[model samples]
Target: MNPIRRRPHIDYELDAGGRRSLWQTLPTLTPGLGVLRHYERRWLRLDGFAGIAVVAYMVPQVMAYTAIVNVPPVVGLWTALAACVVYAIIGGSRVLSVGPESTVALMAGAAIAPLAGGDPERAIVLSSALCLVVAGWCLLARLFRLGIIADLLSQPLLVGYLAGGAVLMVVGQLGRVTGTDVEGETIVAQLRSFFSVVGDTHLPTLAVAAGTLTLLLAIVILRPRWPGPLIAVAAATIAAVVLDLPAYGVAETGPVPVGLPLPHLPIISWADLQTLLLAGLGVAVVAYSDNTLIGRAFKPKTEPGEKSVPDVDPQQELVAMSGVHVAAGLFGGFPMSSSGSRTALAIASGARTQVYSLVAAVCIIAVLFFAGPLLEPLPSAALGAVVIYAASKLVSIPDIKRLARFRTSELVLAIVACLGTVLIGILAGVGIAIALSILEMVQRLARPHEGVLGRVEGIAGMHDVDDYDQATTLPGLVVYRYDAPLFFINVGDLRRRALLAVEKENEGDPDHPVRWFILNAEANVEIDISATDGLKALHDDLSERGIRFGLARVKQDLRTPLERAGLVELIGEDMMFPTLPVMEKAYLTWAAEQAVREQTALEHQAVPGADEPAGTPPARPVDTNESDR
Candidate 1:
């Protein structure tokens, strides 16, 4: 036989009973590497075209965002380049473009300004350090699987934050747009200062800003997929150069340093770290929330049976973003997050993978080397126009209206968050948003909805008694459903509601008094010690009133806690049931026995000397085994 055929049959099957080694599982952890394994040549053209469009859009956009961060325009390009390359290598989202974002940029400026004391170089160093701190927070969040932290900001809160940031962006650029020195700390003061300087507005700068805004908006409306910002920037640069707009009081970017960025560690002391920790945490939360929202919105669509498509992983995103921030900090760049506009453009341009981000990064490096000087003649007023338009796009009136119509309270929360950002500061605004979200959650938990469950004539399962008029309750049973977790914060409310449910049943049907109370606990999956104590107290109170207490659909997770807390012994295992039907069967059998005992005592009372005591039977030992039957 041939040597290959003659070789003993090798057992290549994996060990069924053996555990997987960490080293063997390590490759599966980095999903981004898996994305690169199935690269298709046909996607290169689309990714290339998208990459060019993103670069064209991003160059001017980053330069515009630099104004918000109070950093030199060169810093923005470096950040975009570093973030894109790093995120492409590690990030989970295919189309999400990582770069300088308006909200985070504004937040970074606010955080670093006071510490830097008006020194641009110091500000840059502090900002980089802050980015590193944010990276630390992101890494910690990923390690702990705290991706749910993003849910702290509801959509309304996000809407409020973006709208507020947009207002601030527009207000902050008012001075540049009109060539006047308008200064203020708040929106009200800013508007006052803006009006005061209205008469002193430079006509050349105003004209440039107006023309740029109009052109950008028009292009966005007509051809959304086109590189409108690039076209507008080029047009403005040409106009400024040809007409000598600077001579007529139009400010220019002047000179932008060319070449690759030098890598350096952030020069921040331990004291600086102490001061920036809270601010860095704020930035991390805001950045992650914004990035998650954008990433989820633009996540790549999957075809039928497409095994290669990567799903959006929040924890992986945090890990990827941490890497991006670390890279940016090391490369002399400020903090960055996902840019919604750029990501949208990438998707619209037919981007298929993170390769588009890599391509964009290369293009930004090329611009740094070859096209830096060409940006010198770009008008500052035009850049302001670009920032204002980008900011304006973030304010969605339709979303606000929808919130107003559907959820008035959330609308109020959104408005409060927006006003806080505009009038106070970005950090304070975020704090307010977080506080409101927490308050909403607390209110919901504290006042959890409790319903009296009844069986409808034709319905398969029980429902809220108030929901259907034809629904009927059991003759001697009260089924109460508490639709929230039982915890310390709401234990008192749970007890109160249980008592109220009993009182209401007594008042409504005096003919057939409620003898059994059954708590439908499917929704109450979690319980705290306080809630367990409260449950025990409720059971005792029912026992004193001669009413039997039972639990339906009590999950095993909750049962373990109840058992640990000694609540299971007080309520008895026979009283706990796996489902409504089982509970009903046990309750009816017990109720029938109770009816027989009561009827026999009534007959004894009617017949003279039938019993030693009238209207009473000799007390028998409590039969715990009766419920099991």
Candidate 2:
């Protein structure tokens, strides 16, 4: 391993007089230039080897992904070649390999299939247009700095989505694998169709596919680090040519067109554009989500002493992906994204920088110009087998099992997302995953957790009364903690929980009836008019019941709203404290003072000269300087 070399830091602050910020300019212009400038010549040999390996791995995989998109294999090759060059220049990560990934291909195919109306040329045109639309979406997101949008698909949702996509990919390829006319709009329908035609499955195609699949799996299990797909594809191509499998009723990939794709805009109708816009947006979201997830996962590891991975600008990644998609669209190709498998392979094969992507592009160009005919004998079933192998790996069984063991609700969500993709459509499945994630968040916020706080013996800080058995509550004081922000949807619930805490405390010891309610507002980051009004009403209700309302750790921003809502006046300004300890001290002093005042009134009432009626106390004057004191 090379010793971690620290780059010298230069402070280049932007000034008001038209001075550009190096932070803004450098990331936009040459994202990969930093690594390239400090390029080590010794790493070139490894990059070169990795580049060749990527080419070998990418060609077959991209060609296989084309089947998912229902396009000519050459289009997939063009997509891989074009995206690689563009991403190498602008991408944030070094080893991330951009290409026609299966998920994006599946989404693009679904989006364009209706518009194309069974025409392969039209399909290509629509797919290219979709790529352009996706590029536009990426650019929009980057401009708005919506990089955090990728996190909408949480890990559990993503795991389920990919697992569902894996199932769809495998099922969709079954027709090619078995040479059966399995037809359906969805996975369930396709499975039904497949089962009905099971008797008519072509033995030759199934044999080739099964054999190829077995060989690839065996290579993966035995050698593990070898380019198993590439090796399997080559061996399958040789076997098909030598055995004349096409004559024996096995379908082959057909002759690949020789030459690079010419740069041209795909002509798309306005109506088709309108229809595809939503689908393109979905594709962009899923693609970037998957791309960034993979990018972050394999982020360049720092040396032993480093605290974090090198900075990965998500906006720069968006820009890089946009450039790749726009280039892919211009070059007669479909949409693309970062491939996790190829990226891992590149890193494992010793790739050092984006230069490896450039080398891979050059090698792919060579294949297009000279070796296109060599791939003609590759069997369709064998390609399907390769895709199946890749897709099978997408299902993270261990992750699913882990979720099941710990989080049952999230496990159900994962299963539902998986089932949604397999039973509905891939595009709908993504929608379902995103919707579920948002719904889960809203559900948590609506009924957020509440904790009753009490002081623990020998503990320095306050603790949850429910969590600690030995936690002691102050006489006549109920301290409550709301774990979520104060919002219109949850304010009512917060009020109910607060009252319930007081009621529960009183039930525990009716003799020391709860007289003060202190809210720990540390978790309440946001407040709205509805929540503010709710707080005022709660304070009034508590005051009528002879209970004082107090707020602790209230953020500075919330004070303005509380004043505007008259809550500050209702609860008294002195009732708000900056910390729990201060609040406790003030509450204890007030409780003791109230007790003294009551005892004094009682003694005065017992005297014959008392002016107040029996069982009635004279109104006390408000102390304006109490908080100041």
Candidate 3:
């Protein structure tokens, strides 16, 4: 060979035994490089503005959510920053920006207040512990692919639950915004405090709040993506700076540490773990739900206009967001939720990858590292204004309108979940969702749809005693179809109706004793012990009456249970068919054999005058054609 060169890496195949997948380990991608590569793309202008816009909106929200948790505003910034950075690495969603979410923050605050004794440092400690717990839970979830739990939370429940939570969040914040010292230990206590301070509202603060509300509404009705919160926050900061709002009982965003996240792995005692268990569980559910929704929402638009296509891997989202939570805790920060407002901003800004979040993270770091003193002067009122506006977005009118069209029970459940979120707590709201879903499912189970499988006339191998219209039936053979699982709840009705129908068909018909009855098992997924017992009893009773009971189109999964119950043995192999076509063939063969046997018996017994005449025509044939007569 003419100076053979070394084979390129492309030609080198690594041993299959030692290969690791990217997901199994991890991959590094940074926005700076990505942004540089696509500098001339339209995304550069739109997404760049969106990042800054989102950051502006986020600053106040972080402060507000932190406040709700009784932690300092800087902690919010710290947590949000770390979250952004961590998510940039691990998150699959191109636009999702992890940060302090209102619902989760409120939940964290409620959980930590008693344990931390209102100390910011101590609260951070507990939050860190909580974060670890959540991260552990999420990691466990990913390992087990437990993301299906989110699917069980119906849309109606989510809408209602969030609406309820929003109400609670707004009410919870009202006391702090007003000058009144409303007395309460937690949300319920805080609700009382908010109400008590109704008359003590500061006119100026109220005016600011009013103006903010108006701006947000105008934005909702017109430019939905307008930076109303950012503008409102800027205005609040200017007012606090120039108006000396603190002296007039306006709270201020106190000192925020401007440095690294101290790595203090929380050492909570077993006692502490016990106390936080319920709260931890609640946070796990709410955080998973809230984060997944946001993550999936911001997942890159793969199919044009196919917003419903959820491309974000739920397991990935959990891992990413939980990691962010852990990172935030390491850096002396409050608990965070997936930020919807910032996400919307990112989408509006033409962000192509998760780099915008990284940019946001850097910006937060810069603000904390070098621009600290500048932010220190920022007022609590401004942050409060930001919080109010961010929370307002949780209430979606279109969602409510959509909810209105659903079943009353589901709609009521949604409303209950929302109110529960508002008046009770986040956990209760989720519980209601679970309860309602199960209940609705149970309602269907209670009275399942059962139909007589009667084929129309002029149909080949036809049969039916039609419920929808007058139709012919096979003289003595009946087919019943149940469109639900065979279970204890509905088994009694099945036994009663099937037996009665068989008996009625035999009413003194000289030539016909109900010979065969077949149950359509196409939709039945399973039959439990109780159902099996009922079926055994039905088989015995029908056999005693000289009738054969069998099945048609029993799905594969149900075969094992039926076999284990000796149903197949009792029904005989020839009587069970995998498809309707085969079943029809089997039925026709059985009918012909029975007809021959009947004629043979009649001729054999013809010695006496008791023999019936051949004048009586044979029984009507079954027609199984799908079309109606």
lDDT of 3 by residue, 51-144 (tens): 7777877876687677678777777788888887787777766677778888788778777877887688788788878777777777777767
- Per-residue lDDT of 1-629 in model 1, one digit per residue for the tens? 64655667788887433557998645535666777887889888889989999999998888888887777788899999999888887888888998898889988988887788757778889988988999999999987889988899988998998899898889889998999987666668879999998999999899999999999988889988778888898899999999998888799988889997678888788888898899998899999988888888786545588765555778888888799899988887888888877887887888889899899989999899999889999998898999998888889999999999997998998999999988888888989888889999989988989899988987899999899999987887899999999998998888888888888889888887778899999999999888898888888888777777878898999989988999878778888899898988888887788667667756755675555666555544344334333
Worst-scoring 10-residue span by lDDT in model 3: 620-629
Instruction: Give the Cα lDDT of each candidate.
Output: 0.86, 0.86, 0.71
lDDT of 2 by residue, 480-567 (tens): 8999989899999998888888888888899998877999999998899999988988887777776788899999888888888888
RMSD of each: 6.3, 5.3, 8.5
Q: Which runs in model 3 stand beyond 4 Å of their true positions?
A: 1-49, 185-188, 194-197, 219-222, 298-310, 442-447, 456-475, 487-514, 609-629
Superpose all Cα atoms of candidate 2 onto the true structure and report the RMSD in Å to 1 decimal.
5.3
Error of 2 at 429 (Å): 0.8
